[model samples]
Target chain A: MIGVGKVKQYSNVLDKPLSKGKQEVSLSAFAFLFSELVQYNQTQVDNIAELERRLEDAGYSVGARVLELLCHRDKGNRRETRLLGILSFVHSTVWKVLFGKVADSLEKGTEHEDEYMISEKELLVNRFISIPKDMGTFNCGAFVAGIVRGVLDSAGFPAVVTAHFVPIEGQQRPRTTILIKFAEEVLKREARLG
Target chain B: MAPAGPRSGDAIFASAERVNAELFTLTYGAIVRQLLTDLEEVEEVNKQLDQMGYNIGIRLVDEFLAKSNVSRCIDFKETAEVIAKVGFKMFLGVTASVTNWDADGTCCSIVLEDNPLVDFVELPDTCQGLYYCNVLSGVIRGALEMVSMKTEVTWARDMLRGDDAFELQVKLLKQVPEEYPYKDDE
Candidate 1:
């Protein structure tokens, strides 16, 4: 019987000779599956907010576990502090851990000094997100936000993250902006430490 | 140590980036299928999810507690607040604030300023009149219960409105056993 621990080992036994490279997968399957997942969750909940909360929780589990595993892998040496340090970690470490590529853009919030925005143009979760007019409440990109939140908080960067779709008229794909706002205490602490 | 690839090496341990999105979807599908096979009733599905989340929450508390080196919350009231700010933020990227702290201040309302999962896309037509997804409510309820705090999750806004934001209210229902229930299982 294979347990959760063995699942990783099993992959190696079957594939043999694992190498580091990009693996292409069918976007259709994920889209369809996510579509159904939303459908399934819909039947069980009472409202749209509930559904989004459910999806957020689902992503939350991934974030929590992923954060644990990633920290274990990285040897958990130093904790992250300050905005730029954490952003770099998100861009290089968390992005590499989850999406394989560094995000397309990492910009500080122009309006707010404390807020930093991490934008991804070709987000995998949003590739097939089709918000129906009737059910105007759902966004699949919350999963990515969960992951980011997980990684950042795990690394000791306390922040609030929000996902939004900012459409660029000429841009081919939707640009997702993850607004990360660090806690005031965190900023204060960073200043003291720096 | 060599870096792990998606297919080979310790994917989680090696920080592999080559993971195929399809495989992640497949994993999600497999877990849901497994759950479905064991559970039939809609209520049962929700129950199982809560049960599973309860277990996860117990373990998660241990991890977070260890990493943050945070002392146990002074009370379940504090525990609920911590979960919303720290627990939710750590995993979901959204910090739910206490919009309506109860008269007793035990039950609190949490407002979700941003949700990452629903970033670019929108829920389709078929899912209307139904709760978008409530696994989170079940999870929070279950996890807090495990930690000895009874809580119920309610939505502040309906998602069908195409409103720019989403919010949820968590009501503390009862005080749970002081000792976590899942401790013996591990």
Candidate 2:
């Protein structure tokens, strides 16, 4: 047991400032932790959709917090105003901060003006994951999609985000595409403001 | 008056590499909150966290072995020191102090003054029975079990739960020898 006297000697961590130092954690540790999260959520839900919903719910809170923190850290507290600006922020800044690299590409949907896609050749969260045959069409990237939804929703651009796995013939790491569909109201507001 | 050898364990930990503290804390918070909402039972949540930690520990030990160049320790005392100095520092960027060793040296406590996982956490009043940091104990138990050392680990105190300190008690029950069933055929 630590003595009360020792506790008094140490300063409270809350009093310290959050610095802008380049901090990095073990990827293996995070991969293992996330794997357990998927396993736990899998045991709780009956179907793949329910499991993805739960994973998204879990990532939602994180996305909200990350949005606030990242805005403060990288943008000087200025929130992105334009749709392309926010998508760029999510594609480049958010991806770099979270995964230590920029996403592969950001493309506009062919059929819809309000739809956008962000693709990653290899998602950090799914580095150590291997889906079983029983879990048909299950993509752990739903957590990342949930985060994207949370960030967009909180930033006043309400949208629905879904993750899809697209395997390349010769690539070792499979690609994940996050399809983001913005609400009609958002598009109307953007058009009026533009 | 200092012994002429390698520097002390704590000194080594002071120079360890660090990770983005927010990523560690936020992800852990998400996991805990999810478990609470899904299970709705403190005991079940605790069990689930431990089981998850056990699974993580089994895989984590392999990573630890691969990254660390340290050789095997001679005894349990040295083992505790290695775990505190190398394992915790390498993974979490924190050095736990090994203290309160029993007279027989079969049991001791690892005291963590700084825990990244609890940085943004506050145990809710409803989660009275939830052992928020029980995963640490489970990891210790699971990791030690892999090295042929059967041990029991429990949290003696947790700062997140309003305790004065964070202390994990590890007791070495016995050692089990490895058995190869195919050795006779070979």
Candidate 3:
């Protein structure tokens, strides 16, 4: 058992800065577990879309909490504002908090000032995702989309988040990109800010 | 009123890394067992699993915010750093790297390493080339929305093509009102 002092120190240290300590888990375990989840959902899935939706919904819940925990730990209990600014925060901060790395790229919409993109060369989900021949149209990335939607929705960024597969050749893992489309009012605000 | 970003001293990762992983596994096991318990309709069990994940996401949002300590993101760079250091480390025990940075620095790409979650997991013959770890994406999307910044997450490729790498693209969509309604509009 850990002593009170050690626990306090752990709490204090982790509470403030961003930590990069080594922690490992079993991929097979997660895979088997998730497999069961997919299998269970498939039975009730009226269609491929429905099955994916269920998965997305599940992820959405996790996204909500993931966003909160990360922000709380880094900011020491402060909330952020600024639409484009916060999105970048999510691309980097939130991504790191959940997947353990800052995203590969963060892009802004050249045509629409209110729009932006967070790009990663390798998504954590696709790292070991293997779709079966039967479920051809199924892309579990929707689960990720749901999580993004949930996070943004919870944070007051009422927008739609969709997960798509943008495959790039020569890359070992699938390159998945999440597209975020902001509401009209949000664009208006960005225009005014400029 | 809610506290401003980074000011409340709320970002604290109190759980031990090992314990946290165990918690996720335990939760996974429990969810699976419950679903398989009755040998009843699979749909019902799946629904239950989704509901369970939703509940977990809701709670995780609060926990993530409290641990990250990133009250406010002044700009994109700071936001990215926070994700790499605080966000990823706290939950997954790995930090992604930034690659292919745009000249203006407004855009950049992230690379992930040391992913224990993906280590040694083989997809069953039925699901040959699908990503099983998309739960992270869902969790992230749901969590970020709570604090604002309408966003979307997508995959960059199909993982079945013997491709050892995968990517996720994030796009910024809209800005939600600070006092926005939590419930969906009919």
The alpha-carbon root-mean-square deviation between model 1 and the true structure, to one decimal in Å, is: 22.1
Query: Best-fitting candidate, measured by TM-score?
Result: 2
**Candidate ordering by lDDT (highest first):** 2, 1, 3
- Which parts of model 3 are misplaced by more than 4 Å? A1-24, A109-115, A133-137, A192-194, B1-186
Over A1-194, each residue of candidate 2 has an lDDT whose tens digit, in order, gives: 34333543224544545546254455556776788888888888899999999999888888887888788777899999888888999998877777777899999999999899999887777766888899888899999998889888888899999999988899876799999999999899899988
Tell me the DockQ of each model, to 2 decimals: 0.04, 0.39, 0.03
**How should the candidates be ordered by DockQ, best one leading?**
2, 1, 3
Q: All candidates' lDDT scores?
A: 0.56, 0.79, 0.55
Error of 3 at B160 (Å): 40
On residues A25-93, what C-alpha lDDT tens digit does candidate 1 reach at each position? 233324434555565567667977677666655665556555554455463655455568778877777
Q: For model 3, what is the alpha-carbon lDDT of residue A90? A: 77
Please tell me how candidate 1 rates in CAPRI terms.
incorrect
After superposition, candidate 1 runs with Cα above 4 Å error: A1-29, A75-79, B1-186
How do the residues A106-126 of candidate 3 rate in per-residue lDDT, one tens digit apiece? 777688755666666666655
Interface RMSD to the true structure, each candidate: 17.7, 4.1, 16.0
lDDT for position B168 in model 1: 62
